[model samples]
Target: MSEKKYSEKHEWVELNGDIATVGITKHATEQLGDIVFTEVPEKGKSFEAGGEAAVVESVKAASDVYSPIAGEVTESNDAIVGDPSLVNQDPEGNGWFFKIKVSDVNQISNLMNKSDYDKFVTESA
Candidate 1:
């Protein structure tokens, strides 16, 4: 287990060595209302930090989910695509969108830790 890192875009990333599992934060799901659909990046796809990594549709809006670090996507959560509500029910667990083989592990250091992210969210709200 590892501490999750966060992005200003409201994505959460759990890093284990060079691999990172990513998903939108619970606050993001709450803001989206009810997630109705999801489009995870395909395996083998590559993206930069802050890139549009996926699409999540909610009753209120369709939002682009951003990557917190640059990497080649290694896996995507088919479970979330099949049952979008999982995003709202367990955004941090089974709802994780994708996993990546990070190209630059140092990029993660630029992101906020849990406490910083919590404060950032609070200050923004």
Candidate 2:
């Protein structure tokens, strides 16, 4: 597993070679409250860095999940669509929204590391 990269919008990406697994941060899930619904992107759909890639709704509100890096979605996790609580239970694990075939691996460098993201969340809160 590679080091996870984070976006200011609270999405995280862990790349393994050219494929990147994307998901919301645990902090994001906490802020969203109990997750109720999720809509993952379709396979083969391409997105630019920061593009809206998925939709997640909690009891509190609905939010768009963005791709931290430009890529073509290669897989979507249906488990979260069936049981949205999975995101709340494990936001950074099995709850991952999708995997993408990265269009530019270099884009990963533009995102924050875990420590930086933790600090960002702290200061922003």
Candidate 3:
């Protein structure tokens, strides 16, 4: 599989075939250090673009997790619910939050690839 793509809002999506794994980016986790709790969506629930899909709570703040694409949640990382710091530890790997069966593949085209995401992050800094 290829490295994940990212959104301007600090979310990442990794596509393996039609299923997409979604999570907050490293920058996001760093901004919300020491995550303590997570409110994840129930598997099988569908959410539209920009819809609230989950919540990540850190000692510093609680942030809403938005859906980068419209899709049905297929699975969630229960490990993060028990140990939210997993996100703070590895935002791109063991820290992933959920998986979704994507509905609109074309939405993938609108997201930033690694290079573009890097540029966006740098400019926003």
Candidate 4:
């Protein structure tokens, strides 16, 4: 089974077994405007929770996409790199940045669920 979680910085992580797919939230894309570029981490690259894992740039600004949990990157979505606008078009689906072999599933518990993330976005705005 897959469970999705969100970070305070607006990254989303969906865990299915040891692999966790990570992406910026839709709210993040909305804030970023039209995304023009993306740089995904190379396969085998390791990151600690909260470590900067990728780069996403929009017409308005460039942002770092952080890892929500410690892991080694197993795959990256080249589709988003080839067509950056895919992030704005589908931030949670095809826009996913990478998949990692999660080092500690416990870290996922620290992130928010959908309802909590929605509330956080609302209260922060």
Q: Residue-wise lDDT of candidate 4 within 22-104, one digit each (tens)?
A: 99999999989999999999999999999999999999888999999999999999999999999999999999999999998
- What TM-score against the true fold does each predicted structure earn? 0.97, 0.98, 0.95, 0.98
Error of 1 at 73 (Å): 0.5
lDDT of all predictions = 0.95, 0.96, 0.89, 0.96
**Over the stretch 1-120, how does candidate 3's per-residue lDDT look in tens digits?**
646789988999998877899999988888888899998889999999778999999997888999898899999999999888889999989998889999987788889998999899
State residue 105's C-alpha deviation in candidate 3, in Å: 1.4
Worst 10-residue lDDT window, candidate 4: 1-10
* Clashes by residue pair, model 2: none
Badly placed stretches (over 4 Å) of model 2 are none
Clashing pairs in 3: none
Ranking by lDDT: 2, 4, 1, 3
**Candidate 1 colliding pairs:** none
Tens digits of lDDT, candidate 2, 29-116: 9899999999999999999999999999998888999998998999999999999999999999999999999988899999999999
Measured over all alpha carbons after superposition, the RMSD of each candidate to the real structure, in angstroms, is: 0.7, 0.5, 1.0, 0.6
lDDT of 4: 0.96
The Cα error of candidate 4 at residue 33, in Å, is: 0.6
Q: Which candidate is the best by lDDT?
A: 2
Task: State which candidate, 1 or 4, has the greater TM-score.
Answer: 4
- Per-residue CA lDDT of candidate 1, range 51-106, in tens? 99999999988999999899999999999999999999999999999999999988
